[model samples]
Target: MTDAPLIDPFQRAVNYLRVSVTDRCDFRCVYCMAENMTFLPKKELLTLEELDRVCTNFVELGVEKLRITGGEPLVRRGIMTFFDSMSRHLESGALRELTLTTNGSQLERFADDLWAAGVRRVNISLDTINEAKFAEVTRWGRLPQVLRGIDAAQRVGMRVKINAVALKGFNESELFDLTEWCASRDMDLTWIEVMPMGDLGNEDRLDQYWSLKDLRARLAERYTVTDLSERSGGPARYVRLEETGQKIGFITPLTHNFCESCNRVRLTCTGELFMCLGQEDMYDLRPALRGSSDDTALKEAIRAAIALKPKGHDFDYSRQRPDGQMTRHMSHTGG
Candidate 1:
């Protein structure tokens, strides 16, 4: 391994990596995927051992934070084995953090194992608290099951953060309610603007484009919102509510592009590395990984991919249409 850090063409040190362990998810979230989704064949996905090798190479190349993502990462069979494998990096202090983004449906069963494997924090996607509305949003998810999962995560001393999509008319009304719920539990909440990803048969991306600018304005009406300089190594910009002492995050990809400070890259289940979320440019690392026992080619492939990282994404919602939309679903790239 080289003694140098992985710096992109723009001089940004790439230290964070998000890897999708599987493209298969239990819930069919309306925004994330089509109602009748076609998942990837199991054979195409990188095995747990292969994922560990790829991630280990990344860490050796100066990657500090590794986040496991998926259609729903916890749903993968023997997923805990991957988490256990990554824990060695955490123990050696080479990796700063090893966490995952989940749908909270499987946390009830795996929360304890996750905590034991050095995962201290988790990002759970919860769009709404209303049982009926939750069902409507997730299409196949039950509120009680997810709530139980959340409880289990918290019970195991894991810090839980809620990630809610800011849907125009769907979740706009529940903003304050969600805020209060998270604040009461001492969990931070982040509101994300819907991105124009894969085509949903009956779901229109244009209609769902809710700007975080407008969402923040609505939040200011109820609480004293003050911007914070803190960044969690992701795209979300944060604010602190003085009234409740709660931290709120806004991920405004369309309204406010975060590509200028991009320090992370996403790896798909099949070994495709996406440098930008909204762009279609990607480099396949599978050939390098599978071609040899030595990681020389794999590391070179990652460096070459990082060199091609674009300055920013082209997600534009100003033309009254979903411009710069990718052909793949958000779930395909690990959401």
Candidate 2:
């Protein structure tokens, strides 16, 4: 076995891996999935043990950061066991970080266990703070429940970051409100531009599209925004708010492309590897995972897939239409 690092064709070292544990989510966010979502059968999904094995292989291949994501990861049964298993790598200093992106629905129940498993930081998805608007956006989510969960996470000493999707007509009014809320709580805030993913029968992507360029300009009207050069191993470009002394991040996929320094890959629950988020190109690893009793074949398959990583994604909204729209829901790929 060669002890070589995982580097993509673009010469970018692949040190970050985001694994989607399940496609099923408790909340049907209007922008993420349909209200009536049909999820993958449980039998088809990889077992928790298989997920740990795949992730361990990546860690061995020089992947230092592992982010567990899902429609909402905490909802998955026996998920803590996987976290416990991965903590061994962290203890050994082989993995630098083990964090997750959640909707903050179940943090009240699992916050202690997550902290015990060595998770220090978390990213919570929240678009609005208004109760009525939150219900309308999440469809089945309760604003109070999520807020309580956030409180629980903080109580357990977890550093929480809020991730909000910048929707034009939906969250345009709450821009300063959300920013102030995060700043007051001492939590970092990142605003993401909506990408053209999935199909909603009535919800139009163009109507929902909100460029971060304009969002930043609006923020500049009230605050002194200064661009920062540091990255947090993700696509968000950050800026510091001088008055509030807080860091605000912008993920502008449409108006600006941040793919030149791409160093991450996503793994689905069913053992599929997506080389690029915007591209349909994928390599199935179930055969290698299930066929061998050893890790040789599985590692080879991962290396081969990484070699095919593309230069960048094609997400454009300048044509007055959702160009390069993906048929797969964002929930399916992992938010």
Candidate 3:
């Protein structure tokens, strides 16, 4: 179908792929989605067999890491079976790691099953630790439920990482307390700067954007910050926490872009390929996936699409409209 999928147009070797399994989410986060919205129909989503084939094609072309995402991956019916199918790739040595990103709404009930299905790493979206504040931020979320889910995931020995969005007016005050709590638990914690992506439901969301640089400066007052020589091979540049097994990282697309070393590609639940998260470039593959069972066809399509990957997002918030603001919302693209 094509040559090795290692090198893209910019000579960046792609080794990571984030696949969105579904677009339906339970929570209505102010930043992710609006309160009233219609989700894609189930018939439009790629079947498990189709996803397996897509993921397999990527693995065949030097992609060693697979992270399954969703509006909330757990809410997708028959997801456990899907994990069982993906687990085979891990067992066969086709994929080096299998991880998930979730809102932690259903983690308590599915954590044990996830471990059995071969997932050892997970990222949970939690913006606040205070119960009342959590409720206000998530619209209808219960902090206890999410915390229980995190506990369940930990009990199963899964590597847990908490992803908290830094909200200027809401969670900034709690950042230190949350960091201390997570560090005490020996869990890796990352704070993502709130971004203005897509036509978010809440018009005032952009107003809530917080700078990760400020957070880092504040933490530097108490803890020793040292750059990690190596990280988990993700976009974040991790720094080891002083005197603790935990690490603190920041994903600052606005302040410090990581696109120069970007190697990640995304596949939406509906079979659309997004070469860059903050760009509007998208290619639909549902026809290729459901048309023929020929694996080579899909591989060729993937290669052709990625060949035109952008060098960087070039996102400047001060501009009239950032490229990311024109792209699909983060949830629609995948978590």
Write model 3 residue lDDT over 1-335, tens digit each, in one string: 35476678999999999999998888878888777758988999998888888888888998989999988899998889889988888999878999999999999999999999899999999989999999887887899999999999999999889999989889889977898889876788998877767676536645786778888888888788888877566668788767665788898888788888888899999999999887888888777777788877787788877887899886666553444565467788796
Q: State in Å the error of residue 143, model 1.
A: 0.7
Worst 10 residues of 3 by lDDT: 318-327
For residues 243-272, write the lDDT of model 2, one tens digit per residue. Answer: 899999998888888899989999999999
The root-mean-square deviation over C-alpha atoms between each candidate and the true structure, in angstroms, is 0.9, 0.8, 1.7
Alpha-carbon lDDT, every model: 0.92, 0.93, 0.84
Give the lowest summed-lDDT range of ten residues in model 2. 1-10
> How do the predictions measure up, each by TM-score?
0.98, 0.99, 0.95
Q: List the residue pairs that clash in candidate 3.
A: none
Between candidates 2 and 3, the one scoring higher on TM-score is 2
From the highest lDDT down, the ranking of the candidates is 2, 1, 3
User: Mind giving the per-residue lDDT tens digits that candidate 1 earns over 1-335?
Assistant: 36368999999899999999999888999889888888888999999999999999999999999999999998899999999999999999999999989999999999999999999999999999999999998989999999999999999999999999988899889989999999999999998899889888878988887888888998999899999999877899999999999999999888887888899999999999999998999999999999999988888988989999989999998889888988899988998
Rank all candidate structures by their TM-score, best first, as comma-separated numbers. Answer: 2, 1, 3
Error of 3 at 293 (Å): 1.4
